[model samples]
Target: MSKPNGQEANHSRQPLLEGRSVSKYFGGLAAVHEVDFAVYPGEIVGLVGPNGSGKTTLFDCLSRVQDIDNGQVLFKGVDITRKKPHQVAHLGLARTFQVIRVYRKMTVLENMLISRQWRGETLWKMLKPSHKDTEQRARELIDFLTINHLTNEKAGNLSGGQRRLLEIGMSLMPNPDLILLDEATSGVNPTLIETIKDRIRALNKDQGISFLMIEHNIQFISDMCSRVYVLNYGQKLAEGTPDEIKANEEVIEAYFGT
Candidate 1:
């Protein structure tokens, strides 16, 4: 097994997610411009950049949260650039936001169970009770996240890192093949940051979940991502292994500024 980001053993020939000349525009500004990248099955990839460099914008395009002005996004070998967010989610792609999206008033267990509420076959099938298996899955994920002790606790009361874990748990309820994690470490304490890293490694190794993470935590990316993509001013700046990325002069000028 490759030590950095569990690289070689996990990657297969075909990419699980691909962006072909993908672009998104905000009026006159090109927020993301014809960016191309890939995340292979069971692999962890990182997207990093200085602030306003289009990392999260690219995530939105891939997740179908924002309409791409150009190019295509394929997930699990299916075209998803035109799909709605929930439709993409149904097709085994899930994402957490830069801002944590947990329901603060709801308990940890309730948040988990409710995550499936959006997947109701019919939009009108509202306010229905959670199925038995759904509850079981929620409990299991809570335990896996080491938040079982907080299951009954309101999400509002938990710390920043705990909410991040809960959001991850919610994403797992979909049984997704790939998850686009948007800054899983921001605002988290050092201790909890380590916990998040360990859990992500376990999920990638044990459960076979592929990840495309957008992060500013440089060390976190080095430790978890096999390949890193750097974006600057909404275009891809570089793509390479962690060590190679560290040595890239262009990245140093545009991102590291060292």
Candidate 2:
């Protein structure tokens, strides 16, 4: 619960991820328009906006899930605008979707195993004894997320919150430098929401993983984020500590129309 380092330190350190004037268009509509964003190393930054305010589109553009029509995304000072999603993941950037994308037919253990195969290991190589380390790491993460009891259960049979936990565990498999989470607490039960929040804090504190999260749950964002960015009509509306965001008139209007 102690605050992380100040924004002064964040500004001193080069950003782990920077989106410079990034834009993405769907035909004539601009889903995201020339938005400048940054997530400093070891900081939990929040992105919030009304529905259709382009928060998710901005996330997609930054994560390379959707190609941008203009601007560049830089990760660790390298331009990753041209990188494919897998390539981006390989560069220590990982993300979870608003809609959980777990392999339903696969068991919890199988899902964890597949996440560890980020290097595109061949089936033969995966089945070899060399993957013991990989399997062990998977088990460790499953235990860390407290889903070890469901290791052999079908992912499809799990509840919404369980699937969210599993997907978060899978994202951590790559030991990513930064994780972009889109509505991570949505539809999750109150108890599980606290669990997800605790895991996020633990990851940031214990493992030093940075996070850029998009959430509609204001209380959740306020609880976890050190800094927050607001978007309205595909444009940057405000950026500051959560308190400043709560007081900003522009942000107030954006969410609760004047």
Candidate 3:
């Protein structure tokens, strides 16, 4: 997979995340074959494929939600293939699930604060007065996502798009270096989708947060991603820019059966 648009010039630099011959299997069935993927620092990369094409499976493997049957995953040059999920999160990697996971019963502010709590923090620490710094940071992120008004509302009361936005904000609570977003725009309205896209771009531009996104919205991917990888039946089918991918014969055939 050759990166275009001067990305090839940065090949000498280390990628923020890399998958080398990564594979995952469920029983005898291979959900993900040996796939090589890379996300450079501060880059917005897209993973697109038809349903059951292993896009989410690759995300699972990368995030340590599912262990790979073969090969390895590297984050910031450290082998994280064998690390636990929480350990992975602690090591500057965070991911959002395909299904939004939120504390429905809790207020949005509590949800955000809880996300910032480390694994070993004691109950007493949580019961202690809310750290002004943490609360302020959470509020700042909520405002950045334009959901500050919902700060005191129950998370379950939020709309689907709002929940998605909240989830993204929660992922940022940990200040991760790379975020794997699974369908960030799925089921979101066009207006909110554009907002999500703009926020993603702003995060990348201002904070240097790199992203690897699994998206079915071709136009969304085309607009935001500098590079993309296509999967088919759990294998790498192609890798290129959005225009090149749209024009690729295999991609068209795989998606449209043309």
Residue 164 of model 1, lDDT score: 96
TM value for model 2 = 0.94
User: For candidate 1, what's the RMSD?
Assistant: 1.9
Tens digits of per-residue lDDT for model 3 on 51-129?
9999889998888888889999999999999988778888889988899999999999998888865333455676677
- Candidate 2 has its poorest 10 consecutive residues by lDDT at 1-10
Output the worst ten-in-a-row residue range by lDDT, candidate 1: 118-127
TM-score of each: 0.94, 0.94, 0.93
Candidate 3 clash pair list: none
Global CA lDDT of candidate 2, please?
Answer: 0.87
In model 2, what are the clashing residue pairs, if there are any? none
Model 3, residue 207: what's the lDDT? Answer: 85
Best-to-worst lDDT order: 1, 3, 2
Encode model 2's per-residue lDDT on 1-258: one tens digit a residue. 456422222667888999999999898888899999889888899999899999889888877879989999999998999888778888899888998988999999889888766544567777889679778888999899988899999999998888999999998887898999999998899998988988888888888889999999989988888889999989898999888999999999988889
lDDT for predicted candidate 3 compared with the true structure: 0.87
Report the lDDT of model 1 for residue 173: 90
RMSD of 2: 2.1
